[model samples]
Target: MENSSRDYSHINGWGIDADPKNDPTYPMKKRTNEEHRGYSWQRPTQQAETVEVLHSNERPNLTAVFGTTVPPSGLSGMLRRYAFKHTENEYAHWLPLLLADRINVVEGIIEDFKNGKVPNIFAEKGMKADLQHDRAGLIKKAVIGGLLIGGVVAFMAGKNSNKSRKLDY
Candidate 1:
C-alpha cells in the first residue's frame, strides 16, 4: 500500500480533544480509582413466573424482573405466543405482534362495554389536546381519514351495482 501525504489536521475542529486542557469535558472526565471497580454485586433473584410471559426465542431464560399485570390472554395472547415462536429478526414475529396490539385495543373497548362502562374515547385519544395545540394538523388528519373512508364506500357501492347489473343480464 502506497502512503499518500494527505494531512487531515488542517480541517476545522479536527483533533480538538487531543489536548486535555482544550477538552470541554476535562473537569468532569477525571478518572478516579473507583472508576476501575468492576460490577461485584450479585444478580437479584428472578421474579416468579405467575403469568403467561411471552419472551424472545433467542433468550435462554426470562429476565430478573417481569411485569405480572395484564398477562397475555384472548386472541392477542395467542398472536403474541405465535410471535415468540419465531426469531425477532423475522417479519413473521413482528407483523402478528402489531396486529395483536390493534386487536387488543378493540378487545379492551369491548371489555369496557361489557363491564357497563362507556369509555370516553375522545378524552382517551387526547383529541382535546390536539384541538388546543395542533388544530390545523388535527383538521388535516380528519379530512384525510374522511376522504379515504368515502373513497372505499364509493368503490364498494360501484362494485355491488356492477354485480347486480350482471345478474339482470
Candidate 2:
C-alpha cells in the first residue's frame, strides 16, 4: 500500500505527517484528531462535527469508562446522616453513643432545674432574684403612670375651680 501521507498535500500548514488510510494506528474506523492543512479557522466543519457527535454520544457506555454497572453518585452528607439514623445497621457501633448524648443533655438540664438554680461558677444567684427584678420594673412603671394621670387631673380641677370663682362682669 502507498503511504497515505505522501498521497495527500498538507494545505496551509494544517495537515499532519501521519495518514489514517495507510497507518496501523488508524485501523480503518478509529477516531483520530490529525490536523488537515486545508481546514480553515473561519469555517471548521469536519472536526467540529466529530466533536459534536462525540459529545452527544458521551454517555452511551458508562460502564466502559467507569468499569462498573452502577455509577458512584450518591446523596450528600446531611441526607446520608438522616437516612442512616432511620435505618437499622448492624455495623454502626457509634450510633448508640450519639443517641445517648441527647439523653445526657436532658439529664443535665433536669439536674439544674430540680435544684432550683442554674449551674454556674462565678455568681450563684437564686432564680427568685430574676422574678423580683421583673416585679420591681412593673411596680416602677405603674407608679410613674399614676403620677402622670394625677398631675393632669389636678391641673384640670384647678382650672375648673378658678372658673367657678369668677363672676359674670
lDDT per residue (tens digit) for residues 1-169 in model 2:
6856453464654455356675555663463433443444553233212111111122342222222232112232233344344424433424543654555555656768898967662234343554566777656766898999999999999999888889543
Q: For residues 1-169, what per-residue lDDT tens digits would candidate 1 score against the true structure? A: 9988787888998878989999987876785655478647888899999888889999999999989898888999999999999999999999999999999999999999999999998899899999999999889989999999999999999999999999998
Which pairs clash in the backbone of model 1? none
TM-score of every prediction relative to native: 0.69, 0.22
Q: Give the Å error, residue 131, model 1.
A: 0.3
Where does the lowest 10-residue lDDT sum fall in candidate 1?
31-40
Clashing pairs in 2: 14-36, 14-37, 15-36, 15-37
User: Counting only residues 3 or more apart in sequence or on different chains, how many pairs clash (N, Cα, C under 3 Å) in candidate 2?
Assistant: 4
Off by over 4 Å in 2: 1-133
* Model 2 CA RMSD to the hidden true structure, in angstroms: 28.7
